[model samples]
Target: MNGNDQVSRCGYVAIVGRPNVGKSTLLNRILGQKISITSKKPQTTRHQVLGIHTEGATQAIYVDTPGIHLAQGDRNKAINRYMNDAATSALRDVDLVVFIVDRTKWTEEDELVFQRIEHLKVPVILALNKVDWLDDKAELLPFIQKLAARRDFAEVIPISAIQGDQVSVLEQAVAQRLPESIHYFPDDQVTDRSQRFLAAELVREKIMRSLGNELPYQTTVEIEQFKYQGKTLHIHALILVEREGQKKIIIGEKGERIRQIGRDARVDMQDAFESKVMLNLWVKVKRGWSDDDRALKSLGFDDLG
Candidate 1:
């Protein structure tokens, strides 16, 4: 067959792991956009982020999921259920799944996720990440040996998602397993999330940084409005909190917390749009919002509903 007539390689890849395993970091590195928020806090990603990577004849669609865990209360139950459901939904008729595990250690939590993947009759690649924090290769041998023991994986590749080490090799490994097909996304497309969604996510990320871990799982961002006129991107957003005390912390003294968040979010918006950004932010109180059906719907958290 002629080179031009040959079919391209494309596939769906899901990066599944427990919370804070650097799944979002890997997605951003591959797709080259900040679609998912990264934090030291577990369960940082509460939704499925679709990241598209395209080059030449290879197009890889990567799905990032929140850490799957056992559900407890209404909020944890809701979040964990969404994560597991989203992972299962993304796995439908897909080409492969990348199981990301933190290099520091493996616990019962990690084993539980791997066990779930065992039932799925598809290619699974085990990606052991965060090698940069280690000065000794000897530190990673045990984990490597554990992976080798599992004959279930198609391949076992270790990488530092933050440093972009061996990421391309992982991509190439993914591409090698993909069945030949047409490109699923345009060459220039980076992610499935709209500019509006990304803006809200950026704002939420800022809030995650502004406040401590107390604010992350308790807070969410909604894009109130987004418009463009002349040379500026006009945007308004609301940061939702579950309690009044949380709102106070987010607004800070003399509104300094919100000010810092606004400034940082503005810079990211400008970078995304390549133009000046006019951003308006507000801190709103929504009592037990995570458990409120209306609140969840309003904030785009109703994935199943």
Candidate 2:
């Protein structure tokens, strides 16, 4: 068929992996924009973020899900369960699956992710990410082979989500496999999430980055106000923690840490929204919110299975 008469193709593609395997990074790189937040910490992503990438005659809707983790002991909470449910739920009805693994390393979590998608009817592409961090390039083949044997993957490709290495090839593989259908989103739309959700995620990302090892997983951000006034966007975010001690850690001495988070988040907000941003942050102690099912549902974690 001629280029003008080429059939249009669009489909949902789920990017699944263990925590910190660069799922979010790959989605952002593919979309050429930051719809999903990334950090050094695992489980930084909690929601199923849909990044829509539309090219000529193709629209690949990528679902960037939270890492599917094994909840055990202290880690087993309502929030953790919610995250697992969110990740698995994305697999249902997807046309394709991109299962990402970090470099040559495969942990039990990776096995868990593999088990989840092993029985899938759709094509699952095994994306070995973070090859840029590999010290020995010769190990690539063996590692790829090892993972390729685990399942009948549609394709096994090496990638560096951070550096954009071989990502376009991956995108091409995804686009070619998309089933013929109508585009679900506008050509200009990059993500299905609203600005309010992105804003809250950005704030949570800043807190996770700023605190480093001290960061509490129980912390969540809620946008109390998100609206545009004249040429500027105003955001009021409340940071909820499980304990008073965690609240203090986020606040820091003289409230410097929270202010820093606000400043950093506002910059990202401005860049994301393409407008001036006025971000206000406040930390509150919501005891057992993370473990409480009702509290989690109230905080927008109601999308669980």
Which lDDT tens digits does candidate 1 get at residues 90-182?
667778999988885888778777777877888899888998777786878776776668747888788999999999889988988887887
Per-candidate TM-scores read 0.93, 0.97
Cα lDDT for residue 90, model 1? 67
Q: lDDT for every model?
A: 0.81, 0.92
Q: Which pairs clash in the backbone of model 2?
A: none
How many clashes in each structure? 0, 0
Candidate number achieving the greatest lDDT relative to the actual structure: 2
Give the winner by TM-score: 2
The 10-residue segment of model 2 with minimum total lDDT is 1-10
In model 1, the runs with Cα more than 4 Å from the true position are 1-6, 73-77
